[model samples]
Target: MLIFLQERRLPLSLCGWQMRNRLIYLPISSITEWFAIPMVNLRVISLAAPFVLCTSLFALSLVQAQSLPTKKKSDISAPAPQAKTVSLSNIPHAVATAFCETYPNAALVSATWVERNAETCIKLHTSEGTKTRDLLYRLSGELIEMAETISPIALPEAVKETIHEEFSRAEILSAKRLVSAAPTLYEVTLSFGAEKETLIYDAKGVLVRKVEHLPRAVQKAFEAQYPRAEILAFSKQDEDGFVRWVIESREGQSHREIVYAETGEVVAISERLFPIDLPEAIKETLAESFSGSTLITAKRLTQVQYHISVSDSSGNTMLALDATGKLLDMDAQSEHVLLSLATSPAPSQDLKAEEDAIAPIPVALPDPEVDLAVALKPIKVEEPLAAIAAEKKERPVIIVRRYYAPSLGWIPPIMRLWRPSWWW
Candidate 1:
């Protein structure tokens, strides 16, 4: 610290130092009394006078300039926290405007707010026909990515071939394509026995990774229940904590979906049974009605209802039946089901050729703004639209009951003479 001694008029020799300037270099420790300028005893002042000097010529440069160093540039690795979700009304005008300008017709199914690397993003789920697309946008309303559902069959030939060769026994249950700033990849879920495996494949069809595993007990139970049936597919029902296993035995026609609890207990069972699984009574009833006929296939609609397709020398016939093995008339509305199955071609015996041509069916893509109400809807909720036209041709049967007058069996003499073969 620098301080000026108070005895300015004193001669330098009397002050004990002949300094050019009356400044003193005192250690911060000895400067308590010098904080306030005051008259000091000459004897006391003179004792410290020998240290005086001009600060500008000496101490000024000794005081080092100190400040915090500029903070290092931010790390690219630390991702930003996710953005908070807000109501549609809370969306920024710029973002909303950009979205509207880009996808004017998008039918919004849902939306969410997310942040990546400090950038505010709006993720939207827009329904287009039977497909839903996920759209990502920046705060400025710039479209970042537009990812829609893509059928596995629509994947590049290389990708499909790779999957088929690698998992030939595994059937693809669902697939989706993600197109972002990076290279495109397909996410596919395949069913192998009771296990569902998910894999990511590059555009060229290289496998990237697998997803997860299930309880061994659950898998064992599924295999046990459907010993002969090939595992068609499987999915987890998170809401109920149950796993659904789709099993099929006869080509791809017979299907059975069994839901098992996490503990391996049966939760529910719904199977599409073939003709061979029909109750004895039901089989006998069909035999009596359509003699010398072969059962081609049978679809069990419920515990009691069945749609039986039989082929006789004349042609194929469809029979509706109840659980008690009694014939039931098809409902007027369900008449189309019979008509469709009747006209549908029977499965070709050349399974190898049919299997070779298996392809993924793509969902119809519609404009974002199009209304789903105007889209073609299935008249039968239980029937898949894709297979309806195919099923219509080969499985034909409309059993219309023919009512006959009771007196015709023992026709009155007068009526017998006039009765024609068709009339009687």
Candidate 2:
């Protein structure tokens, strides 16, 4: 039987047997001489052929898979490393100078190095009130553009009305006042149901553009990073040939601003600040220097600067400070104005003083002894003509009454003195 099977020309129907619990047939043509077959009966070879062929195929597949070159984990491509943080030394001199010149008092919150149009550049993040400013600069430090993130309240009345008129029922998510390129405009984010819409309006509130969706990569990356963050505002910009997506989101008390490339790489990130997080040093300095002063607000202006609003006994005033909590120089007129305001008396206090000063003073009381004596002075009475005629007097008669007199003797009203009767 073995010799006959090795020939590869045996009758096709001669090999048949039960495999497992079922009958199986093995064609003679399928049996190769190279395959080792046990010296078993014809029925056994047929039964095992299918099993052996399957086993051999699986083993071959495994060997082939193992033989293929394996890729190292490090060989897998990943996104290019983005800038982490930046310092003054890493910034180009021209950029630093130009920035300082443009915004002498602007407080820098952060700086990042990014690639734009195949060239490296700097992105400076600053803050002023609820506004977060992003400035772009060339490698040579030349100013490219500046954009600010503004709150809904900062939107112009016209723009707000336009939004209201258009999306009357849509909830306004956020708004931004952009001051870049030509014609400053406003970017308003409105949400209706689960859909978010971004509308751009010019200074006059005229609709300039609308963005309903972002590039696939940018959206995917953003959603993956911040799945639960409520998107406040979104904007897109084209610098040279590179595109950037600016996204602002709020989660609970935290706020975040992210700039993304069209390729889904995060270029920069800035945490939006609130007044309650004013530096302790700033609060301490204000407390020690301006006692009884209350901090109204403290905003991050730059990486090393802050704009603080405070209310002292006088009034509310805004001042700037450096990173170390040192007071920064403000405009001469503004400094004088704020100082004067700080030193000047409050209107409420001034009014109170005026009221007290205008109050009438009480007149000095007269002497009670002199007043009583004057009131109790005696009175004199002249006799009438009829009484004088009745008395038959030849000369006019005078009568005097006194409350008290040493010269007059004490007498009851019903009795008259003998001397008084004679005088009468």
TM-score per candidate, chains pooled: 0.29, 0.32
Question: Model 2, 78: alpha-carbon shift in Å?
Answer: 37
The residue-by-residue lDDT of candidate 2 on 1-424, one tens digit each, is: 1233222333333336223433344454455433445334545556667779989999999999999999986566433443333455645678888877887766665665544566656678775444567898886877776777776887888988888898899998877766756888888889999989888899888999886577889889888998987665577876555667777676654666677777787766766454457678876778799898654323342233468888789987889853334465677537657866899876798788988789446799876555768678886666787777867766776898869545444554323422455443
Task: Tell me the spans in candidate 1 whose CA falls farther than 4 Å from its real position.
Answer: 1-90, 211-424
Q: Which of the numbered candidates is closest to the native, going by highest lDDT?
A: 2
Residue 72, model 2: Cα distance from true site in angstroms: 55
Best by TM-score: 2
Model 2: lDDT to the true structure = 0.68
lDDT of each: 0.63, 0.68
Query: How high is the lDDT of residue 418 in model 2?
Result: 27
lDDT tens per residue, model 1, 1-424:
5545544665454225565436656554355554443434533465434445454535654554334344555554333543342244545567678766866765664454543465646666665555657778876677788767777788889888998898889998778888888888788888999878888888888887665455677778776766666553355545333243222222233455455556666654555444677899998889899988865334443233568988789987889753334465667637758877888888777986888799658799886786677676656555576578778777889999999655666765555654667883
Range of the 10 consecutive residues with the lowest summed lDDT in candidate 2? 1-10
